[model samples]
Target: MPAEIALLFWPLVTIALYALSRVLYRHYPSAWTSPLLVTPLALIGLAIALHAGYRDYMRGSHWLLMMLGPATVAFALPIWDQRALIRRHWAALLIGVIAGSALAIASSWALASALHLDASLRASLVPRSVTTPFAVVVASDIGGVPELTAVFVMITGILGASLGSWLARLLPLRSSLARGALFGMGAHGAGVARAREVGEEEGSVAGLVMILAGVFNVLVAPLLAMWLR
Candidate 1:
């Protein structure tokens, strides 16, 4: 295929793969079978099989990347629908998110330091808990590698989505909102998807929490970076 044709075709191929992964997940319904878990690996394998360069794949994949910001902002609609419940617990939610965000930043820094990573790499890992769209921007602003941040975010999401339920059971958490908020703040979109598996209320709360965590990290990460430096 010509380069332009391949570039145009990759996006459709990516979407088809993702859709097929979702269908498979519905049939299998296991942690490893999750669409989020499966799709990226499939894409990587497909790319390797085709010997496609990252630069070319991204030429098409950028379409989905471009949509990420708008898609994230659209979460507000669900939040607006749940405004009543949110208002009732606004204080608790705010406190929980702030604490979670702080912990996320601190823990990432500590781990990176323990691993003896360089400053830029440490910065990239700092935003690992936030969703990729937010994490990439934050990482760039903080002298981190945006690509590395995206990788960390993906790994975090997959692990969180896969293990979160089992961990929750181990913790014996009683509140759906708490569970949702933790996962949302810690794991981002994949966690939100997993939250939906529990209940609509959990999913909505997770979506809201994910948005809130993103906003919080955006505002706080740069400042923290400066202070840590």
Candidate 2:
């Protein structure tokens, strides 16, 4: 195959696989059958079977990656639509988000240190609670491996989405806002998706919390990284 044709094929195949996975998960929704979990595994298996290289796959997948920016920005619309609720609870939200954000950073650093991880690994771990693009940029600024940071962010999101509902039930959380905030702060976009599954109010608040948490990480992570260095 010509280089251009090969590149094009990979992206198309990836998209088709993702669509199939979504359809499968939608029809058979189980914890283990999540599209988020299934799509990646399916892609990896296909890539191995096709003997596709990561660089080539990424070349084809870049378009999908680029779309993430706009998709993230679209969350702003929901936040704006829910502005009244946000204003009514701004103080509590801000305080709660900040506290959660602080703990995320602190616990990540402490755990990495306990494991004797290097500075690079610690930097990558620090922004794992936020979205991928935000985490990558922040990780890069703080002298981390952007690739590793992206992986960490994805893992955190998947785990958050998978466990959030169970944890919510197990905990003493009495309010939708509280549960949503916890999900958003801990898991980012995946958590927001899970929250949406629970209720519109939970989803909306989770989206707001995810955005706020991203902003907090962008502003604070670099300073913390510098100090730790």
**1-229 per-residue lDDT for model 2 (tens digits):** 4679878888888788889988998899876777767877888898788787778788867888788688767867877998998999898789878998889888998999999998899988988998886787789888889889988998898888878888989999889889889788888888998999888888988888888888777888668667867
Output the lDDT of residue 29, model 2: 82
Lowest lDDT 10-residue stretch of candidate 1: 163-172
TM-score of each: 0.91, 0.90
lDDT of 1 at 19: 95
- Candidate 2 shows a clash count of 0
What is the clash count for each candidate, in the order shown? 0, 0
